[model samples]
Target: MSTNTEARLFSPTTIGAIGVVNRVAMAPLTRSRADMEGVHSELAIEYYRQRATAWLIISEATNISREGRGYAFTPGIYTDEHVASWRRITDAVHEAGGKIVCQLWHVGRMSHVSLQENGAAPVAPSAIQADEQVFLESQTVERPSMPRALETAEIQRLVEDYRNAARRAMEAGFDGVEVHAANCYLLEQFIRDSTNKRTDQYGGPVENRTRLPIEVITAVAEVWGADRVGVRLSPITRAVGDTPLDSDPEGTYFYLAGQLGKLGLAYLHCVEGQTRGDNGAGDFDFKRLHAKFGGKYIANNSYDRQMAIDAAESGHADMVAFGRPFISNPDLVARLRLDAPLAEANRDTFYGGGAGGYTDYLPLADAA
Candidate 1:
């Protein structure tokens, strides 16, 4: 708990083309504060600017296209309006001396019919319905609609969507982009065998299952360069949709990691366990996975101050990402540096609210 000058967590490091002052990163979080059209509200600029001290701020999961939307009020980066709105946020964060990246997302089968175009069914690798609940425009949660299998020809279009989204991120003034391939989302649905039941090139074998995600990464890397791109992978997280873990998580992810390592990505932002729950260390060998990556690794999920420091000091991780903690602690980096107490966030104001919980949390200097 001592404020030691030698703490690796406080040391400066370069993540791809971006240089950060510390190793603490703000993980992507969904606050549902954007408009129905996926444009972020003006309040988001201040919200992100307040947390600018972190090494990097990964924006909440943003839909890559209209068909990619799952939850209500989540932002998108596929339109000119979306780009204009996000430009304001990126400019604010940069002016405050912080680095930010957009986490491009596509919900796939995790979406409800109400969220899709013309009330169409959600698309997935196969015709499987996730036992997941999605937040509707009415601010209510409902089980996702049954998804239709994506035709093999439609796969390239999904890749193009990711490419265009990455291009928009660049136009919006973001330093980089992170492909959201975790938490049973669209990309993860294809990566995992439990959900992907196709026999085509995108399914069946582990290599085939990971093809679309790899293709998406390749397309995004083409926009921002491989070093400026990161990918989020949850090897064993089944918390999102009650989706079962892949039958061979270690084999599946290790192969994917090795493949991504070949591309020389900025980092593999890994969710070490069940997000918002116990770290499922017993399920997979994270150390081996890190070695397989052969690049920077940003460890996430259930990490405290000491744990983050330990991971950095031991060289187990190049950086650490904190999710919920950053929600209530705008000056999270300072709090961790001083080992100060963190303010608890209100669960009620977590989604679809005004600035009450989003930007009202006072930093330590203001609180004192």
Candidate 2:
């Protein structure tokens, strides 16, 4: 590729009010390295500081409350200790000249009994059990236990939890937050009819199904402002416990894009497939979604240097987020700029480990 072509990926852009020097954004990846208390250790600060060259970095999916946790050692943003720990992380990233956003998550029915308080069932939009297993530091369940359906009033409270978490994120010194409404989590469970069989105002039709996500997004946007808030959506992903497809995937998500556009959020981040390159969900019409959103469009899942460059240069995306690639290539931007060979990430130490595969990845200068 020519210099001008590659320069498109390196060009500066603004997502809402935040000014970024390039369109390369780091996608959130779960490393599960936090302490049992949900306090991130110094290792996390080093891990993020290593990848601070990305124009923007989205932190791992962080629980907003104890009830939201589905995996062990994942970080949370609810307590004072958690806030203080995360402040160090955000400060380090900022000091390294990078912008980082926290991804707020609630795992919903994707929980095992061990993860729940007092052995209580996990909460979800409905009582459906995902055909998936939950992995903890000590054990793994064959399949997730059935979850308790959330009462209408309980959902109201959960929305408030999101708002409070956003406040906590700001207190922790994060640049912004991305609501994890994707991957069969609490919000996505409500949006899909197969999971939400309720007859009340929060189920049945598309309007009812989408109500929870809109309310949650609106609540978070209120705390952080819409310009500083983003939402991640998986329109056709079934990888996370085979989260059933929406009856009308097109209608459901198109309407969601339109509704999100009205909120004037900073951007809409979409995971294009299962993992990065496997489009297991098949083809999607990005143009329609772009038109519906009418805001910044961030494309994720399996983008290479050329693919990202093409997407930005061709006007298909306003930003591109790289996941696993950023794991091993802390200087991913520099490597792509020079067309250098990349490092391979070790699968064994991808999660819940020390600095082996986490912060040990050397930058290009060090390797050379």
Task: Name the candidate that leads on lDDT.
Answer: 1
| Tens digits of per-residue lDDT for model 2, 149-187 | 998878889998999899999999999999998888889
The global C-alpha lDDT for each of the candidates, from Candidate 1 onward, is 0.93, 0.88
Cα RMSDs, all models: 1.1, 1.5
TM-score of every model versus the real structure: 0.98, 0.97
**Worst 10-residue lDDT window, candidate 1:** 1-10
Can you tell me which runs of candidate 2 are displaced by over 4 Å?
Answer: 1-6, 139-142, 276-282
The C-alpha local distance difference test score for the whole of candidate 1 amounts to 0.93
Q: How many backbone clashes does candidate 1 have?
A: 0
Query: What are the per-residue Cα lDDT tens digits for candidate 1 across 185-249?
Result: 99999999999999999999999999999999999999899999999999999988798999999
Clashing pairs in 2: 276-301, 276-302
